[model samples]
Target: MKKILVVCTSGLGTSLAMRLSIERFIRERNLKVKVEHADMGSANFIEADLIIGAKQVISCLSKQNDIETIGLEDIVRRRYIEEQLLNCDTIQTWLKEKEGLR
Candidate 1:
């Protein structure tokens, strides 16, 4: 299973929403993955194969080791949470390619 960390400004509202949507997308696709939500400030506590976040916070987590970062600008849509979640599919593909699992 893949582990993913979702980060946002507050960690409670938009971040949580994105997490749920990702979980649902994984379930619907029958993919094996785990996702955790965190505020940009607590990024150290997160142990993930990949880190997804808004562009505003991506720079902060980009320096971390062993974790891939996906900027939300690459996936975000007009105020729709689902679009953000769907964008993770792109990250998933990138990860697979990087790990030679594709």
Candidate 2:
């Protein structure tokens, strides 16, 4: 399964909430993706195909790692988050590949 990490500065409430939102989206879309949460410091230690967070956080991660990332303007907006997930090319390609497997 493709893995995604939802990151925040402290890895507490905000990250957990974002992870839940992403999980709900994944379940609704029937996507074979694993989602997790981490703090900025811990994120570097975890392995994930993709990382999602506030724009600045993602920017910092992008500079530090080669993983694909999605940066959000509004962290708590479900519609916006879903829209970004739908529009992301990496996610779209993975979805297509999964469809072919089925």
Candidate 3:
């Protein structure tokens, strides 16, 4: 499985919301990915193959870590989140490699 970290401003509300939404998305699609939620302050401590977040983690906290990131302009909308995620070639490639590893 792959690790996906979802960062939010408060690290609780929006993060939790996105976690739930992404969990449903991953489950319904049968994707072998593990998603975790946290605040940007704790981003450096969280290790993930892909870091998914709004502006904070992408533009701000990104410099703290060397991990690849996916920025979300609208975290509340599931459509935009799914669209952004679907368009990420990094995640796609990782998924393929993970499948191969299996």
RMSD of candidates 1 onward, in order: 4.7, 1.5, 2.3
Model 2 bad stretches (over 4 Å): 62-65
C-alpha lDDT (0 to 100) for residue 71 of candidate 2: 90
Query: Please, what are the lDDT tens digits per residue for candidate 3 over residues 71-91?
Result: 888888988888887788766
> How much lDDT does each candidate structure score?
0.70, 0.87, 0.79
lDDT of 1 by residue, 8-65 (tens): 8778877777777667766665556788999988976777877777777787764877
Return the candidate ranking by lDDT, descending: 2, 3, 1
lDDT of 3 at 21: 78
Candidate 2 residue pairs in clash (backbone atoms < 3 Å): none
RMSD (CA, angstroms), candidate 2: 1.5
Q: TM-score of predicted model 2?
A: 0.90
User: What is residue 33's positional error in candidate 1, in angstroms?
Assistant: 1.0
**Model 1: how far residue 70 lies from native, Å:** 1.0
Ranking by TM-score: 2, 3, 1
Count clashing residue pairs in model 2: 0
Question: How many clashes (backbone N, Cα, C below 3 Å) per candidate?
Answer: 0, 0, 0
The candidate 2 region of ten consecutive residues with least summed lDDT is 59-68
lDDT of 2: 0.87
Q: Give the better candidate number (1 or 2) by TM-score.
A: 2
Deviation of model 1 at 81, angstroms? 7.9
